[model samples]
Target: MKNYLFPHIFQPIGWIMFVLSLITGIAIYSSIPVFGAGIAETLAIDSAIIGIALGALFIVCSKERVEDEMTKSIRLASLLNSIYAYVALLVGCTILINGVKFLVFAVFNLVLFPIIFVCNFRLEMHRYNKMCEDEEQD
Candidate 1:
């Protein structure tokens, strides 16, 4: 089978980057003093956003330990689910929010799909692993 994903080593790196950047982004957004120290201006926010998106991309695109058709299907389904969830969010927000808050959400929207996809994919993968373990134990 042909492989297009990143090496498995990148998965851990991506997780690290995703977590650190998410923390940094949260701190900056929440007005945390020490965490936001040094990182200033809109540029800082932009950098964090870019870091988050790249980290999520690496995570979702990285190869699983056992890359098989099942994993591929899981990835595809997770992606589709993410898209549906993202669109629902957008529509709901459009109906319920406006003005500057909406603009902020729009900016953050850039990374939401990948983040959602990663979460869904991880959850499904965990379920699959647990099922496999159960089968092995029986």
Candidate 2:
């Protein structure tokens, strides 16, 4: 199968960046003064955005351990499931939240897509490996 992914190293780096970005974003948001705006303000916003984008991209694009047909199939399934779950979440949030709150949640859902896909993919991979192990033991 044609495996479309980055080198494995990128995955860990991506995780690091993801965490750092969260911390940086929090710091930026907290440090922004009510009345003051300057270079730090702009830098904080830019850095946080760049960090999150790069991190999510790296993690999503990183390679699996064995890029075989089975892995590809699992990845595809996980992606589809994630999409379904995201849509469900969006719908639920839309029904529960109103106005700006719903808009914020929608934005959150957009950013959460990659993270959800990665989580689902890893969960499916783990289940697949467990099944294989059980079969081998049997």
Best by TM-score: 1
Which residues of candidate 2, in runs, are more than 4 Å off?
A: 23-42
Model 1 ranges off by over 4 Å: 34-39
Tell me which residue pairs clash in candidate 1: none
* TM-score, candidate number 1: 0.91
Q: Give the Cα error of residue 15 in candidate 1, in Å.
A: 0.6
Tell me the TM-score of each prediction against the true structure: 0.91, 0.75
Tens-place lDDT digits, model 1, residues 35-93: 44444556667777888988998898999989999999999999999999999998999
Worst 10 residues of 2 by lDDT: 28-37
Model 1 lDDT at residue 116: 92
lDDT of each: 0.86, 0.77
Distance from true position, residue 125, model 1, in Å? Answer: 0.2
